[model samples]
Target: MAKYNDKELAETSKFLSFVLRHKPEAIGIVLDREGWADIDKLILCAQKAGKRLTRALLDIVVATSDKKRFSYSSDGTCIRAVQGHLTSQVAIGFIEKTPPQFLYHGTASRFLDEIKNKG
Candidate 1:
């Protein structure tokens, strides 16, 4: 799981919700509800909000977010938000393609291994 101090978590969550609910239109870039936002645009938004758009901050947020909230292509060249609440019981592979790598597994390796064997 992604680790963050209270401040960082709050900031990242706010940023995510802001983008998801309002889209980029509020900041002059027009984005459809389910569209990608470029790094430059994200930086711009952070700057506009008076947040420092440092590489460290960006990396922390991306690394720490739940995989269900976002996705990136195999090469890590493109990213988009996954639709819907993470807790909803839906098909595991609802997104177009399987993720290039697994992000998190809830419990210990022994448990995951048991699950894998059972399935």
Candidate 2:
């Protein structure tokens, strides 16, 4: 595994959140209703968006993220950020938790209210 410094990880995480969770259309990639995006398409779109998101980097990001932000599909052909959806497109299954102390932390500030209301 390649070692990534804190800054590199942060930048990559931010980029993934933007592309996977919030605005995949920003890079012309499509995320399904469950937030799954084709890994190959994600790479191509990210390159078009001027971001170098290699498969190796994606794996590293998914592995190293402290918050466990991203995930892969069962066949490993898809990827998605675990949270922070800007649209209703993603429907990640969420079970009710106790007290609601720990809940979704959205990517944008505008989503905070919606999360609070929905959760």
In order, what lDDT does every prediction score?
0.56, 0.84
Instruction: List model 1 lDDT by residue over 38-100, tens digit each.
Output: 656666776787766544555666667765566544665434556652322222344586776
Q: Which candidate should be chosen as best, given lDDT against the real structure?
A: 2
Task: Write candidate 2's Cα lDDT for 33-72 as tens digits.
Answer: 8899999998988888788778988898898889999999
Specify the highest-TM-score model's number.
2
Question: How close is every model to the real structure, measured as TM-score?
Answer: 0.51, 0.73
